[model samples]
Target: MNVLNTDVLVIGSGPSGLAAALEAHRNGANTVIVDSFARAGGQYWMQSKYGLERNDRQMQAGANFITNSENLGIKTITDAEVWGILPKYRVFIQQGSRDSIEITARALVICTGAHDFVMPFTGWTLPGVMTAGAGQRYVKMYGKPPGDKIVLAGSGVFLWAVAATIVKAGGKLEAMVESSSNQFRLFSLIGRHPSRWTETRRLLSPVLRSGVQRLNGYRIDYAQGEDRIEAVKLRQVSNSDRDASQELEMETDCLLVSHGFRPITEITALLRCEHQFDTKKGGWYCKTDPETGATSIDNVYAAGEVTGVTGAQSALIEGALAGLGVSEKLGFTRNGIERKRARLMKRQLRTARFADGLAELFELNTNSMPRIDDNTLVCRCEDVIWGDVLKSWDDGAQNLQAVKYWTRLGMGRCQGRICGVAVSRLLANQFDLDPRIFGFNHPRLPLRPVTVNVVHDALARKSL
Candidate 1:
């Protein structure tokens, strides 16, 4: 195993990670970035591999940022997955097929980002059903449409982004169903952040020109098909105590669904950093200082979605702040550092207001989860359905851990990343208690899946 050392180590290559590395390197800290993907850019800045000329503003900005990082001589370990972090910031990484490495850093910046949050419904696990993020990556990164006839049913502006990507890829967008009924809230965003008008217009232009049907206050009740998604049943999401609205069936080969995004907090959780649950900020996110992105632990900081899903703009600012925070902690402060921090802090406040508006615009109602069929699989990894969870509840399983022990609801390859949120909601609805009371799944060693050989080699190393 190769041993490496750096003054600052960043665990992601997205907007936050890249910004963090760049700032740290520029501030005279030996910086290194490690990412699980083969390339530096994370999902939001996913680069195209098809070698096709395109005019994507976000992609171009990401390319420029990555180029700047490379030009600054920052080391980035690609196609590497960090499996464990030991005391003193010793990170064990499995790089590629035949390489394993240990990196010890004086300061660590965690920007693992967030993943799609999808609630379970009937036929959700069937073929041609995926999250909106997956569909976007398929079109943006691989340059291939996920399906011919696509129906995006979820909440948030992310759905619109996916719809635009599909349209750009020349895929047929059947419709876009958003559960949020607050269309007026969207206009309020332009008032708060007038600069967003251009981006918002650009994002909505393609979908509007393509004449895709946009259904507000609608949700997917269930998906239907034989071997793949042939149709989806949509129901109007009512806020009042009125009679249920009629279900509408839409024929489509693909169904992309997302309730929202949840922060990837495994690393912070594993390190026992303080966390608080706020659905608007992406549930169970790491608690950090607003000014510096410092976590509860010393010499460790968190930024970007790991702190909360505040989008890319805020992530970039938070990342730079975290970098500066680390540099200051390491006694590597340069001239005008305090002034730069103040400016970033003020900008973060503005972006945070925008993020708050976004959260309100796409707020999810947990009460609706109880309406899902009992046969719907909540934990896709362990094949645990609502019925199974109810049975566990009947058997005296009151908490998430107890349910896991009784029905294996979260002991799967994803380690509860995919199923934890839904199961928590199910239990909260079943027991009529606050979802936070159940807490999240406890993180264990080997944060991500690792081969036995890699673990063996890591254990054999003296650094362990």
Candidate 2:
């Protein structure tokens, strides 16, 4: 392994990460960006490794970003997985399975994005049931539909986007379900954020034109089949105050459900950054100064969804601010730096207002856990059922950590990323406390699982 040094190191290749890298380089800082994916664009612009397509606006933008970043003189390492970060900005990365690399940077920008926040329901672990984000990735990135007939059920506006993508891709949609029933929010957003009207229309046009059955305020009660999903049970909630009562069942090959998105904060947590639990902004987020993107840690900054779920446009603006902040901190003072920062900050504020409205529209009802049978698996990794969790609690295993100790709730292949939130919410409800009281799982390195060979190679590379 060889140790590489740079002035700024960005941890993701998404919209924010790319923007940060370009801005930092333009401001006269030696910058390096790394991503686990083979391609630069994150989920929004998931261009396939085989080739590029300009059929869609996002793909075209991604293509342009890739081409522009190539000429910007910023080093970008793709197909590399960063496993660990230590004090003094030391980052350990593994390329493929065997090779290792270490990078040290004066200023760090963490743009690690987010993942679909899937709230567990009865039979949610069925084979054909997947996250709405995962379904979109399968269609957009891999060019494969998750199933022959897809039923989209979730909160957030992203559900419509996925539904449209499927319908546009010549696939069949069994139905589209949104747990949000307040349709006035859409009109309110249009009135407040006129610029977003076009985008909102674009995402919804195909679904409406297809005339697919769209259910609002309906929750997927469960799915039933022997091995994969065959039928789904839905309950209609008339209002937020009322329990879902009107039951409906439909046959479908695939069920896509996502409450929203949770920020990917493994690296931020690994570095011990301060966090705040914001349900509206998707769960626990690494706190950063909105203007500078500076975290509690000196010389370390954060931007994009890792900060919160502010979508791609806001991420672009935040990333630029972080980059400029890094440039200034590293003694690379460019002309009109303050003016540039001010402009970026204004743009961020505007986007945030609109994002807040959207969040209000799709906020999840975390008030209670979805109705589940006694045998429903809560922790998929450990095969821990709801009964097991309750049993552990009755045995004096209080709090999430205690439940984990009793039943290994978060101790699995995912290292608690997937099951942690669901478990926390359940515990919060059981304890009659806010979900944030329990906090998130304490992440340990390596954040992701690594093979023994990779570990040995990383160790052998260092002669200390």
Candidate 3:
């Protein structure tokens, strides 16, 4: 195997990754960035491959980061899907269309980021039902609207952004149903965290101007269609009387739903880093030193959404701190490094306060998900339903491991990334146990899907 060594290896190209790479390079370290996408920007600044029009202010911020990183002589390798990482900072990356090489770093910065948190609702497995994030990507990145008529439903401010993107793409939004009450608490937090004010303004502008029907305290009860989603059933969330919870049926070609985001902790978990279960942090996050972003393992630091679901501003600031911390740890430091770290921490804290408020306001109401009937599909990859999990539980499966063994719940192509949380939620609700106790499915080598031939070739090559 070809071994490429670097002083620092940053494993994402988003705002956080870009900042880390730039800062580390500035501190006199040989740094390289690897991302799964074709471009450097993460989800917040996802660029269109076909050169789509972007009016959102977030795009400019992302462009600035990209430009700064390029000017600092930072090297970025796009379309490199990192499947595995070993101890002593060895990274196994697969880029079949290009060169597949293994990377070894003196220090590692993990900014793997987060993915859409989708709680299973009735008919969620339907073809026309997608995540709000996916809808945004379709409109902004793919340069195509998801459908002619769209219904956006979920928590968080992200849905509004998705709505805006659709409107910008010249698609009609039938309605937007959010579970939150739009209370004053979230509004009050915006005042304290001025860093996010620009983004907040940009995301809300299109929605306010589009005049889309906004249902403040409503949640999707279910989606109904045979070939594709034609309509959705919505219920008023604030109503105390279940029967009086006004039910409305709205016709739509697509239904986009997302609760929030869940951090992609597979790599950190595989590294045996200690993690803490915090719903507000977007499920399990790698526990790190807030001052340095260092994990339990020496020379291994985590930044960005891998640590938590705090927004882009916090991610960028934390990345800078981690980059500086790595530089100092590697004996490459400049004057007043401590002062810089302190300033970054303060900024991170301010952004985090606003993020926390959003998380609280748009927290995934586990209660909002309609009760899963026996036939309701829970694990999409394995095609396992609620009945299958119940059967495993009945067969002396108490925790996730035993359940997985009996039902093959997490043994599918996704490697339990999607189904693990759903399984945990189901087990917790059924047994009245803490969801964290089940932990996550124990991670193994070859974290992502790889071709059989590629795996065989990798095994054939001797370790350096």
TM-score per prediction, in order, is 0.97, 0.96, 0.95
Alpha carbon lDDT of each predicted model: 0.86, 0.84, 0.82
Clashing pairs in 1: none
Where is model 2 more than 4 Å wrong at Cα?
A: 49-52, 238-244, 366-369
Q: Which candidate wins on lDDT? A: 1
Listed per model in order, the count of residue pairs whose N, CA or C atoms clash below 3 Å is 0, 0, 0
Writing each residue's lDDT as its tens digit, candidate 2 over 394-451 gives 9998788888999988899887888888778767765678888778877887888777
lDDT of 3 by residue, 277-368 (tens): 89898889888898888999899888999898988878889889888888778988888888888888887777787778788888766556
**Evaluation by TM-score, superior candidate among 1 and 2:** 1
TM-score of 2: 0.96
Give me the overall lDDT of model 2: 0.84
Q: Find the 10 residues in a row with the least total lDDT in model 2.
A: 48-57
Decide which is better by lDDT, 1 or 3. 1
- Tens-digit lDDT track of model 1 for 10-123: 999999999988888878999999999988888788888864225777788898899999998999999999889987899999998657889999989999999988888888
